[model samples]
Target: MLIRYSKILLTAALGALILLVAINNVTDYATNYQFVSHVMSMDQVPTGSPLEWRAVTSVTLHRLFYAFIIAVEFSAAALVLAGAWRLLLRRKAEAARFNAAKDVAIAGLALAVGLYLFGFMAVGGEWFQMWRSLPDAEQAAFRFIGCAALVMLFLGQRDD
Candidate 1:
């Protein structure tokens, strides 16, 4: 039984880590969109050139996609943590409901966001064939959301 909890907790920890990474990217985007876009334009960066990860290059960061990504990531992290908290406390009934709801958000909204970004990366990203190939900040926000989802899933599975 203890081993089971440990396993679940371990899973949660990994998931949280991924989610945190995604969140960090979201922060970077929120904080640096304008700067990045300016840099991109200043550099006269060709669309086919690799994206400068550390360098603010894309003015497009101010787009709706960026905002949507941030919101979805936030939701994933928030709901995942909330559900995990309930489960950790051994509130099985509540945990189940909360976790279920969170799972829906993560799988639905999170999934959509991820897919959209992936496509954007492929399309405007020019198949990542650009010279620098950096994604401005590499989107740590998605990692954070993924991590949070993992943790919540673990909690939901816990026998406690």
Candidate 2:
């Protein structure tokens, strides 16, 4: 039971973290948008190189990408919160039933992985070469990915 509650709490905590991050993105839009713009535009990276062509300088596209990122984060937050609620409701059920309640949380965590892995690492890091940028944006993405992945591993453990 203790382990079950711990899982529930951790899941809820992950939901809260994602929710806060989404809220921050919405409330403090320009900050992360700058990160996105810089990464996508590749302006911070040294000019004159074969990779220069990969930069996406269109303002419209920058806003679209930022919006897409926020949307995914918000969705993940909602899913995880719902998953936490489901777990709370089923905390006392048989182990199998309680385990079944984890699906939404898993989905939410997977979305987080996708955001950091696909959006940040693949698109920004490799495609746009955000890692090569002056500020090195890859670190932040790696941190977020690590946190999400760790929580996901913990959430995947079966309750005895």
The candidate that wins on lDDT is 2
lDDT of 2 by residue, 58-122 (tens): 99999999999999999999998999999999999998998899999999999988998899889
Q: Highest TM-score among the candidates is held by which one? A: 2
| TM agreement with the true structure for every prediction | 0.44, 0.94
State the TM-score for model 2.
0.94
lDDT of each: 0.45, 0.88
Over 42-90, each residue of candidate 1 has an lDDT whose tens digit, in order, gives 3445554455343433445446545655565565545545444533555
Model 1: residue 146 alpha-carbon error in angstroms: 8.8
Local error of candidate 1 at residue 27 (angstroms): 6.6
Which 10-residue span in candidate 1 carries the lowest summed lDDT? Answer: 123-132
